[model samples]
Target: MSSAPTPSRSVIHGDALEWLAAHPGTPGASLLTSLPDKAELGLPIERWRPFFQQAASLCLQAVDEEGLCVFFQTDNREQGRWVSKAGLVLAAAAELGVPLLWHKIVLRRPAGSRSMGRPGYSHLLAFSARATVPAEASSPDVLPELGELPWSHGMGLAAAEESLRTIRRASPSTRLLLAPFCGHGTALEVANRHGLDALGIERNRKRAERARGDR
Candidate 1:
């Protein structure tokens, strides 16, 4: 039998907290929402409280010992901070060692917007994390994506893959789809051509202009 080295973990997370807090109450995530499982290290998920108690608690201890969660979502701490609009919660947990469950979500505006443009979208790769578990949280059947983008690189990509890897082993029937149909031109065509069953959503029209970056 061959044994391979274990992969490093990360989470590619967006500042869901910043985006959601921008709005008082938005139904998109407000109605029947809960914490999600299967969070990757590079890309932080929507900060589902109580649901991620185990990981969140561990994250708090790591932050307390290391001065920060080391979210691993991005190299640019500033950009990641923008996504982790609720950094204070994580910071508090680190300081007190008492985890605090978060509001479950903090959404940002769509990509390519400045200062909560749509009040529900953002381009920053920030994080929305919690320290404790929530009573309303539930486990997700499928792994969630960070920034919900089409790129296969960066902290988010690393994070997503890590989560998917674990999930595949735990439940082989569940599959992870990347960059599901988000780009124009040969990108989507390529996904179809390869029979890889690309998984991503691209509602933004400007994505068409990003043909050069498509792989």
Candidate 2:
């Protein structure tokens, strides 16, 4: 951890897999990321399984025994059937010895505003190298604060912030929040706003510049 290169706000512009391979951290550091969906990326559904499988392995390797990962994903309609992308991640994590600690629903859809053929909610799944404590004593499994949000690459800022709060409660000593697929630094902004150190990695130069508040 001490040997890992640090960037401003700990955010670096590079591949997350490559970064994680070199800078694994201890239990006090956690990852809160809203990954790009296969639909959003224009990738086939079949490709996501292996991709997330590899990602889960990398994430589990990067964190310590108690370090947790909060993955934000939404269910989508694929060729007339509903598919849970989070489910794929769950299986991937399980294969790598990480267990699902909690599954939170971000109720982003308001009454009558639901999109046709899509679920009305998104999921925030928390995982840890070790078994995660039950979330019943802390935050509820359904988050109602996500009624409205600023959207970027299909993720909302307020929603991401609220989700991070849940993870913080679970990992109170966590000092840094890392977003591997940071599109416009939404998670990074939210983490910094809460007085936590945040790191973002984006391969897109334009979005990365926007995240840094540069013109």
Candidate 3:
């Protein structure tokens, strides 16, 4: 009997960055997309702190463990201390020999452009991981539901396809993990379109049971 080859530890941490810093070669994901139109720093900035907190905590922790780390953000705000966070995250990753993938997922909703009976939000996944390959070509994270993120809850420009393409071109070997509701599965498909391995993970016990019953 042949044993299954162990997949490299592609640590896909979900809301667990605090503990993932110790793990080697774990890339990070950005949640923020962009600042609201006419948005300015101040109270709104308070909300962004959590983003920095999570990134800082993970980076610092990674340093202590002599592990590698990456900081990925989606917020497109180039003002205030956001740039500082990027510098700090990059510095920490460099010190620990960790690579970071920082890319933006662009979206575009042209009123009648969305699918799934929802406002059509074109998915454009982007990021950069300082690993062997570019982080642009990534697979799905949660099956057809990449990231397991509900379509209703998905946020972004919904039309950043162009930006995503740029990221893919920058790094053509990165795999994208996706889920069933994986942000239109565009990123996974994008990676696949670009000759990258795209993977999907889904928590579909209920659906699987229903399918078996029907069968």
Candidate 4:
């Protein structure tokens, strides 16, 4: 028996927005990313809202027509009011005429749990301009728990796996997984482990190096 070939992986330290702008409508590629929140960006909610929408729009634009752009977002409270990152993504997708393929909820904490800061559940949403998900391809809308986290801000291992599986089933032709604002490259590692080529861009040099598994 022959061994399987290893998948290719690349981690670039740069601005994700600039990269997305420079390479719009990337072919044979799908996106899996989490946009920075107000806390990470050091911006007030007023400023961060528009920035988040713009980033989401850019990510949507960068995806191939038949490819999916998946976002894993956690809702947070600001000034005693809840902010919905998934809603922001939906707004951006609507602006670009991209239809939502699926929206799944991943639990950060067990049901009936209470949290004071971030919500107990995170949103996993997928969008595509030309691709449609078949009825037979449907998966659970709610995942009971997040498997594990490489970092506080990293996407959970279980969630990442589910996202990739959805992409593989919905868009079999997708060969590359593009992750912007990749943090420590949780998604990149997961993608490569599952036999897909991975490319990630992070502005933080240290995080970029870690994403590349540098020693």
Give the candidate number with the greatest TM-score.
Answer: 4
Over the stretch 1-215, how does candidate 2's per-residue lDDT look in tens digits?
A: 46634423755777777877787764467787777667655778788656766765676667656667878787778788888777777877877767777788887666457576667778888887663565464767777646435453546665677667765666677777777877778778777776677777777787777666574
lDDT of 4 by residue, 1-215 (tens): 99988999899899998999999998999999989989998999999999899899999999889999999999999889999999999999998899999999999988999889889999999999888888898889999878889888889999999999988988888999999999999999999987999999999999999999994
The C-alpha lDDT values of all candidates are 0.29, 0.71, 0.33, 0.93
Where is the poorest 10-residue window by lDDT in model 2? 1-10
Which ten contiguous residues of candidate 3 have the minimum total lDDT? 29-38
Alpha-carbon runs more than 4 Å astray in model 1: 1-157, 176-196, 206-215
- Write the residue-wise lDDT of candidate 3 on 52-79 in tens digits: 5544545334221211222223333344
- Top candidate when judged by lDDT against the true structure: 4
User: Comparing candidate 1 with candidate 2, which one achieves the higher TM-score?
Assistant: 2
TM-score of 2: 0.82
TM-score of each: 0.24, 0.82, 0.33, 0.96
Clashes of each: 33, 0, 44, 0
lDDT of 2 at 170: 69
Ranking by TM-score: 4, 2, 3, 1
Task: State the displacement of the C-alpha of residue 19, model 2, in Å, after optimal TM-score superposition.
Answer: 2.2
TM-score of 1: 0.24
